[model samples]
Target chain A: MKTPVYFDYAATAPVDPRVVEAMLGLLGPDGDFGNPSAVHAYGRKAAALVEEAREEIAALLGVAASGIVFTSGATESDNLAIKGAARAAARRGRHVITEKTAHKAVLDACRALEREGFEVSYLVPDRGGRISAAQLEASLRPDTILVSLLHANNETGVLQDIPALAAAVRRHGALFHLDAAQSAGKVELPLEQVDLLALSAHKFCGPKGAGLLYVRPGVRLEPLLHGGGHERGRRAGTLATHQIRGMALAFRLAVESMAEESSRLAGFSSRLIEGLCALPGVLLNGHREARLPNIVNVSVEGVDGEALQLALRDIACSSGAACNSASGEPSYVLRALGRDDALAGASLRFSMGRWTRVEEVDYLLERFGSELTRLRRIAGAA
Target chain B: MDELHDPARYSPRVLELFDRPARLGPPPGANREGQAENRARGSWLRMYLQVEAERVVAAGFHARGCPHTIAAAELACEALTGSDASELAEYRAEFLEAALPLPPEKLDVRLLIEDAVRAAAHGRR
Candidate 1:
């Protein structure tokens, strides 16, 4: 059987062949496979490669190589940034602020802090899925030590105004942390304004299990792991050199192609939105103009979202419905936007990526139209 | 992962039935009809049964749910068409559970189908 057409880039992207080639060079016996911490010739060779990879990743964010701390992925980076920063600044303040629509990594990290006598204020977003800088200013307290927010929402693709929010956080004398897992390679980031940022390689066609957190010089963070003095003692583990090389290559490639790729993706998104909105009761879920180019989330009327997903089996996409989840609840991100359970359950997220072509988009539009018509008929809506 | 080991995602039977559902919609001249829904999960099933001399002559179902639920609903309709009307209650959760080998998390699907079948059977009685 043919593979389903992949449109779930927001979930995870396929590893680019160029990235894979770079990684394979560092993995075999003939490659730089020695531990960076060792003192042998092989170790020196491996250590140099790791440093070069660090610089490549840092160049994309316009940050210093020394400030980068490698981790397993965005979740780990998020945990290190939020929990580590909050704990290190506990004496200064125990209050932390974050948006309601942040990824689970950020929200759960804040929640864990809340359990440790830290007060957390979750700022609710406007209906357009944006948390205004004014909202952040209002939520900020003298005791607020950190404010964590996502640069782009994974589910809705809504882009936040990080520069404005960072300025506000700075004015209030608190650290600003950005979860840029979804936007790192896809959009331009204001690195100088953000004190801390988390990025995952897989979001932009790199390997999984390799990510980094950018901690500005002089930013204090309590180390989450303690052992060998790796990642400047912030995170401790032998680095996966192959994965790191792949991530850096992918990040660099993404940066190189971002401008052209973004415009092309925006066109695809517009076509998708136009075609989907033609169906009755279909509503766009996020800010029409402020969201990222690759993602389009919409809630359809008069059809069960899960059934529609199944009907569009040829299109590999995701639904906001919690049918696949153990809790069987609708998407919390959708619910945060004031959508009811039914509407939230009916939402679908279509995220296109580098490999997506116009023909595939056209096919998806036709397939989706037919499936929605069939489902609506079964539900007696048409 | 291989399809044989990952029972949680999709089974061949479920995928086959979902791709081309059998006994969908109310059959013509059906006397008994019942509907069941799990509002939280957005699963709905409606069953139609035609009974003659205390035996089910025909059965059909219309469903708007996940692939597992749709397949289960279709399977229930197909299974009950030749079954006795009095034996409807016997087609409980375990019966469908064994047939579909559905993931444990999807037991609610079985309940929805069972509810529809029981309702249609009661209406016939």
Candidate 2:
């Protein structure tokens, strides 16, 4: 048996071998390893590959290549989109909106904006972790300049109704920024209503250190980095030719196989969730039908979250509690949905991906059930 | 290996007890039991001791907490068994601290174990 079978794909998928193969062509002396900004022949070759990758990624996303501004992965992309859009539109309004359960990148970015004298309204999602369209509409103010939200939540795999939320933001004349790091390649991104969208290649089996933010043609953004005139003055770092190539190729591959892969993963998710919920005191964490197909989160009662994780040492899964020896903090995402600190900490998040096997899923279910029972028995809950 | 299971994060003794806490659950012929709970951290431990002729003959416990807290309970129970009942009053969580090598954040957890042990002793009179 493979040791530590991975089910934490939502954290980051292993880089596809194809992506690795594509990246290798751009490195070393014989490859096109030249500064993309130079007018030399090598530079021109490198630049051409970057442009080709841009076009490839744009085609997969069904958007114009010119709209894509490549950055150093989702965290930077998210910071750039939220801060850039908010700062660019600051003269128009000082108010922004997001949900309480948004990723730390999004939440911390909004918090930083607040320090800059911008007002932010963090709307609480319903019990099922859905930010209703009506709830968003009521929060929109005349001075609301930007509304940043996630298409799919990272922790619970719960997807927000982007189309409805986008329409609400559109009617209120606010620019909508989406942190689609978790949703891109997994779901169809309805960008027609989105003003800015953030994505990380690693989320879809692309290389690390590669990501992009799509800014609609007319959307103005204040540049986050300043020095070089790269990315048409939006992002200013020297282009990472290999990482970008790998990211584009990975995105294309994932999107190409999206339909079939979505169905397959949905089946796996259903099987895993069913097996988990069958266990005594185990609960499915997110909405049954309204979540991403690859991610399954559940909280097991009467087991220490850390102990349960240790028991399943052979299964690489995540606990809702971040278990540093010093601090045991429950996931704020779970807390936002009204889960108590204990249950939230005891939660497990198993995210399957392209490499996941049905046999591995069954093995996980079996191990999870037996280990849970043992832990409960030790805790005297059985 | 995940960092949570890293040997550096916890001692071998801690993992040993956590994997198979031999003193878990109520011991047979237990006339006294005491429990302690940290509602904020969501850690709880119940210690059951069987005392004969003012000396602890057996000690066991059930706990819900991180590995450190659970290990501390198991260690406390092991130390209490076959000792004079007055030793329960003298037993310091500090001893388990060195045995489990608990961090400062988990100091309270060790104290919780001590509280349970002292409670079991208090129930005798």
Task: Give the alpha-carbon lDDT of every model.
Answer: 0.87, 0.88
Please report the candidate that would top lDDT against the real structure: 2
The superposed Cα distance between candidate 2 and the true structure at residue A85, in angstroms, equals: 0.7
TM-score: model 2 vs. ground truth: 0.97
Q: What are the per-residue Cα lDDT tens digits for candidate 2 across A73-118?
A: 8899889988999999999999999999999899999999999999
* Candidate 1 local lDDT, A13-123, one digit each (tens): 999999999899888899999998889998888888889999978877788998999998999999999999999999999999998899989998999999999999999
Task: Tell me how each candidate scores on DockQ against the true complex.
Answer: 0.42, 0.67
lDDT of 2 at A196: 90
Indicate the residue-level lDDT of B83 in model 1. Answer: 76
